[model samples]
Target: MRFNKELKNIKIYEAGKPIELVVREFGIDEKDIVKLASNENPYGTSPKVVEAVKLVVDKMSLYPDDSMFELKKGLSNKFKVKSENIIIGAGSDQILEFACRAVLNDNTKVLMNKITFAMYEIYALQQGAKVLKTRCYRHDLDEFYDIYKKASPDIVFICSPNNPTGDALGKEYIYTFLEKVKEPLVIVDGAYMEYAGYKDEKKRVEPKDLIDKFENVLYLGTFSKAYGLGGLRVGYGIANEEIIKNLYKLRPPFNITTLSLKAAVEALKDEDFVNDSVKRNFTQMERYVNFAIQRGFEYIDSYTNFITYIFPKEVSSKELSNRLLQRGIIVRDLTGYGMNALRITIGTKEQNDKFFEKFKEVLNGY
Candidate 1:
């Protein structure tokens, strides 16, 4: 049997080790581990979603709605877009993979910023697509413009409040790019948009608004972050109905689980929960940012739930991360992202405080 050559070269994503795994490895108690990794909501799933999931658990024997009818209807009502324009998935990660499979061929090249999500490159390689990585830390629009002008790729992935960097590209820059790039499909990955703190401002631009204006633009959103449904693995994409129709061709039957659909439907209905999560996340992030600055730490002003901070020149990110682990604090080391930085997810107030205390102790010892 012959295997695809692309599969051999693909590097797997190294997710943060589970608390139990870390505890076993370090001989630490599980309760002691403060996981500030994976950017998960420390508050856990909403009460409404928990109730919904419990209600649906008895129906596990039944297959889920392959079309995700109720979930799509809820999302449609929430976003004020037609149900046909939305495509539900196990997670936005799966939606991204479906997009790659639907649109990319061996001849296709995928374009993304230097420090964007790792999944983009993984999915591209899996589909035997060549990836053109542009050099930009914070989605530099000029660099993107130049690359778009030179080589028109099959797809361009843009992550606002980008992973690892925690910086967002301005709305003007995105609009300008949309105006210039007419050929390739543009994916605006807004997985962390709820934590982005720009919803009410005039400068805020929801990529969904561009669907009617730009045929090739796709907006990816997830229930994982603000909705506290990361464990449920549910997300969606918004696009022109035509593009959504094409993407749906790649989706498998019963792609979303039954409980996930139920929980997501209920979660979407709880507007107050979404608002509260965003508000709390913003407050926690603000405190961390202020603490980092007052302590003379070098970091970017972040719009997302996580903050990426550069360790002191002498301390490698790996060493710092290991020390953090020994203290039972799991923060992400960005060595894989090609930068000597550490990405710490904003946790609950108590969790964040514990992490800060440990972080400061680690710095002092160094």
Candidate 2:
């Protein structure tokens, strides 16, 4: 049987290389490999979440709380929104799917920047929808204004602290833009917003702040980043109740596992753990940015856990990525994103040193 034509264009996602793969490829010990890809919190999960997981470990024979009652309540308490306004998924990526499946289709279109998250394009194409990417590197509201109105997209995605390029949108800019467009639903992917303002909550704009003002908007978040729970894959979406109610129908009954549910709920309660992770990430990311500047290497000022640096014309990102990998340092290659950059996750101090020693070696030898 022939597959749907949409499958022809949908490319498989290229994830960061696992530590095991690196160890096996280069004959290096697992411990010697430094993984500065995927933007995972190198710090272990919160102590509270560990305890919560152990408590649920004994109940693996049974199914998870399909309704996600406690997790929703915990999120509500933390974000100061009603429980009904929240939806949990295996990861925020899955929540993204639910959103697309609920609204996007063959006839509609979606909007994002030229180099935002690749998943937005993958999901939209999977549903046979057209993706209206902005002309510039960043999705400047002013630039998208006329083009967006002309296209009349069904949905718009704002990947604040955009992937591959970590620049974020300003609050006033978004508010003013919102005033102009009142039709299409806007979904803000704030996966890394916490890291952008690691020490200051006021620096990050919450989706709750916009929901009441704008009737057609949803906020997607992931516990994988700040919570140190990427292995568990817990994520959430917050929006107006009416939009939430419709999206809920697309959710599978037991999408989130029991351990993940427990970890995410406890993670929400222990905001201090997340804060510490963000604080440390910010400190480390700053050093990398400075190092890039001193070396005269072009790089983006990251608001997230990872920084993307453009290699000089002499060395392609492929060559840089290859050199780092030979030394057991795994970072993201941006070829798939159509960028001449290499993205490095801001790991701990020691880990950062390991990358630098090898990265400098690559540049020096070149």
Candidate 3:
């Protein structure tokens, strides 16, 4: 059977290689690999979520609640939005695709930053939308406004604590953009929001606060990051009831597993666990930033669990990553993200220490 031309042109996203895959490819042992690639909580899921999953596994033969009533209710209580305004998906990634499908059609223009999440570009391409990508900078809303004024895109994706770069846009910029762009749908991808530091600080902006003010804004969140439920793949989207209704129209039934939904519900209740994860992330990020400073490596100030830094010009990121791998440390080589940089996920204290030791050795030409 022949596939559609759009499907043919769709490029699959390349995630960081899994430990098993790397071990198989390089003939290394599993225990030796340090995977700091995916921005996962190195300390796994909370005991509460783990227990919930274990309880739900007994009913694995049954299908999940397609309506996702309980999960939606939990999210509603947590976010202070009505249950009708929430849409659950396998992951926030699915919700992103749903937004693309619900709003974008052929000839629809889309605008996003040049170095934002790669998935946004992929989705835009699949939807046959005209995608305009601007240069990367911290909260450069003026550039986006200029593009929006010209393109009048049907959709705009903004990732707070943006992926690969790990910087966030300010609320004032968002409010200004919202005021200016009335024609487009603004999507705030906050997959890393739980790790966003200084909730009361001047620079930080929480999309949840702006939800009531902007009818066109959609906030996407996930349990995969701070909750350490990446393997379960549960995420959610919060928007106005109208937008949620349109998204639900295109979303498939039972897109999320019963176990995942149950686990995510419990994950939300585990406030202690979430707080610990956030605290650890903040501490580790600060440590890493200091390390980078002492080593004279250029890096953006990060507000998320992962830190991205430019390797010295004399040393290639790919080469450095390869060397790290040989020494049982794994970090992301961001060549595909159009930079000679490496992104290291913050792990447990011991893991962070081990990684830094290896990193220092690598810098010293070990």
Candidate 4:
């Protein structure tokens, strides 16, 4: 049985451990588990989204609207983009796959931050394209441009309010970078963009402004974070009609489920709910910051729903993660990313309190 040679180089992406897995592994009660690993909305989805989904339960027998008319219209209004400028996906990552498939080839090269989303390199490798990284861990546009001027890669990814790290690129910096690069297709993966926008006005990367300004840019957004619909898995891309049209050709039919479409549509109408969730997230986030400060630990200033606490070289991040896991508190260990750190999602007040309690107990061992 032969596989593509690229498979040998591609490492599987590891997701956050689930509550059920911990229960089975450690004999912990499900209720005791507080999962802050996946960056999910600790408050859950909007009530209106739930009610709207329930109304569509019996309709699952039929296929979803592949055209995605209503959801597209809602997004069009929200982002001020035309329907032709949009393409929906199971997650923002799928649109990323579409973008990769549409452009990447064996001889092509893709560039991104040294430590951004794992899926960026995964998708690029799937198409046999070479992957390039900036010298720094975060998004450094000057370094990216230095590579861009030399490599002239086909696709460039910028994950604003980047995953794992939680820092965001400023609006002026992004616009300036986009202005310099015209040939390569720049993918701005704004999965946590809502949280960034809420935290600081200058950090917001408006898709409307991006598309209106440059045809070479593709902006990705998801219902997963602030909208609290991660399980529903509905995401969309906004770009020039040409880029969107090319991506649409690669999209499978009826990609999003019936309930997902309804849920996303209803989720859009409840802006107040999303706004309230973002507000509450930051309030809880401060507690984590203070905890890090009081403990003499270092952490990155974040604009997203999660925070990454950096550990000293002597401390074992793996052991800390294992200790927390034993206590039924799930947090992501960045060991896989070659960092001695842990990325923790800011949970609800009650959940965050529990994490601090268990986390303190675990840290005492070190």
Q: Count the backbone clashes (under 3 Å) in each candidate.
A: 0, 0, 0, 0
User: Clashing residue pairs in candidate 1, if any?
Assistant: none
Question: Which of candidates 1 and 4 reaches a greater TM-score?
Answer: 4
TM-score of 3: 0.96
Q: Cα lDDT for residue 337, model 4?
A: 86
lDDT of 1 by residue, 177-273 (tens): 8888889999998888876744434335575577867888999999988898888899999999888999898889988888988999999989788
Per-residue lDDT of candidate 4, residues 1-366 (tens digit): 999898889999999999999999999999999999999999999999999899999999999988899999999999988999999999999999999999999999999999989999999999999999988888999999999999999999999999989999999999999999999999999999999999899999999999999999999999999999999999999999999989989999999999999999999999999999999999999999999999999899999999999999999889999999999999999999888999999999999989999998988776
The numbered model that scores best in TM-score is 4
**Regions of candidate 1 where Cα sits further than 4 Å from its true position:** 198-203
Q: Residue 310 CA error for candidate 1 (Å)?
A: 1.4
Stretches of model 4 off by over 4 angstroms after superposition: none
Q: Write the per-residue lDDT of candidate 3 for residues 204-305, one digit (tens) a residue.
A: 555467678888999999999988999999989998889999998999888988898889889889978988888877877788889988988899878788
Candidate-wise lDDT, in order = 0.86, 0.87, 0.84, 0.95
Q: Give the lDDT of residue 319 in candidate 3.
A: 88
Candidate 3 local distance difference test against the native: 0.84
**2 or 4: which has the higher TM-score?**
4
TM agreement with the true structure for every prediction: 0.97, 0.97, 0.96, 0.99
lDDT per residue for candidate 2 within 84-181, as digits (tens), equals: 89998888999899889998999999988889888899999999999998888876988778778799889898888788788777766777788788
Estimate the TM-score for candidate 2.
0.97
**Candidates arranged by TM-score, highest first:** 4, 2, 1, 3
lDDT of 2 at 363: 85
